[model samples]
Target: MDIESQNSPQFFSWDSLPEQLKSILPLRHSYLIKNFNVLSPFQTTENFEIPQFELDAFVDIDDKEKAREWFLSFESKSKTTMPESRRYEIKGKKVLFREKRHCIHSKLVKEKQGNRELKRPQSSRLRNTNCAATIHLRLELCNIELSHPLEVNLRFTHNHVVNSAESLSFRRVNGEIRGKFLELFKDGHSPASAMYDYEDALYLSATDEQELLVLLADRATDPDYDYIAKLFHKYREMALGDRNGTSMFKRLEEVVNDYNNSGHGKAILQEYDSRTGKAFILCVVTNLMNRVHERVLQSGELCYMDASASFEPLNTSITLLYTSCMVGALPLGLFITSDESEITLEKA
Candidate 1:
């Protein structure tokens, strides 16, 4: 682009910008010049005003629901469905909408002369060169009872020129989409899977996945983790029921029994501390591991043993014996113990 063209007050195509610059661009263009320095000598010197679009104007008397519907219609149209729209006073009935990005305020520093004199160092509170575009909505409600009809008013304002294409791309989960997500959840798909499904259905960007999930969770009346856990428990219950309802320990025992029945291993040995009467060590050396044990024995070098406290399920420790061989490091034996004490190590 020529210097004159670069300096012109012309709109730049969103796709033409590099990926690194896309994120810094504001949703609107009014604050663009103030937030960024124009290096071109012929750059536009005139002040540019942000354009405003009046979405709706309505006053519902004794019909709060109708007024809310009208307000939400504008919200849905603009696709400004971020969770940052907050209800300030439930009794007073007011909702405030603002940009989701937080202002990265400059750190307060004490003056060199006086420690008490603290000051901010920058003209802008937000980090980097991006304009913190302030797009907001204020909904006020007057009166509660039917004695006098409730007065409702919504005012939408923005400090930047709205990007039509980008604004339309914002996600707003309507009833149909929300119902689809709930149906997937009811069908036992995980939250992550449900989120992917929603994203796929709408062709949403990966950056909006978390925001979409948050919106879904709000509609579902459950937190994301809780919803995921519920689905997991449901599937786990089904699996357990199909397997004759065996507990985790019982399943482990069944595997050990099968190994013994096949003559591949003997019953696991349990050694208890005589004074405490608690099983301190549980050792197992299966027939499959016999070759490894023999190799370690033939090498005539003491096998290295290490005990890890993190592996066991029931607050126990696991000890493993390994030896270097021609093939590689071979595991000689496995031991599970209640505690990694001298007695337990000696017994293993």
Candidate 2:
């Protein structure tokens, strides 16, 4: 993806940029200069050629903690200012923070599904801009005090105009708000009710979404109802234990442990494809499922399966193998798989 060789690279001296592009990076530098006795001219040396940007600016920070504080602010500000930026950890020492493209330029993905262009993404504010604006930080462990300053860099050219209002969907809802919504939901309040309940206990909007769906909102302010709905869906997935990802699987395992301890069900197979990480396979025969399965075997009753691809957060398909008898269609065993291929299912 690094087409820097084709972009006709342009380099501006760090000193020249303070006056030229100062408005582009409005806030971070003044804070750095005042606190860190900032280097007058950030030496750009060989320019640590990276394919990310047509233009790059480098700065040094002697104080690791302050630099971290600045980083925290910088990242938080992106939620409303440009796009919700995500950090891609490079090895363990550096991070490349870039804007997400919101799965916008996806024509190529249609041609190649393996490209994962439509996957869980960090969306960008504008599409096809290939916006070369980024902030790369050479980091040190924050847990302990470190002597050397981490190298910080930024890319200043944007092919499109940056606007805060365009990034409203990328706004992050705080954990407190999500937790409160979950509590209200668990108490049987609908998503709309949950939002109202949260607001009743906290901030009050003249209209239902007056405060939310704004250009910017603080922790005290609620997020758009869509975010709340997404959280509800996420909660269902976690409870179902069908979602993929290492963290999600670990949580599902906790649920499995609880199920086993309660003597309610036994998880015969709890497996994931570690190599490709594209599949989640689990087989569970609950007490009810087992009883129906045994009755079908003894009575030679009709057995059928229902397949559903609505399993969320991943492409896992759930197939319910059930037996029909006087008691009705009862599940014998649950089959969850990512592969819908004939050979794979036949093997299963």
In candidate 2, where is summed lDDT lowest over 10 consecutive residues? Answer: 31-40
Give one digit per residue, the lDDT tens place, for model 1 in 30-127: 11110122222321123435333211111222454644454355344443332332334445434322122111111211111245532446533222
- Per-candidate TM equals 0.31, 0.36
- The TM-score of predicted model 2 comes to 0.36
Clashes of each: 2, 7
Residue runs of model 1 more than 4 Å from their true location after superposition = 1-251, 262-276, 286-288, 295-301
Give per-residue lDDT, candidate 1, residue 264.
71
Estimate the lDDT of model 1. Answer: 0.44
How high is the CA lDDT of each candidate model?
Answer: 0.44, 0.50
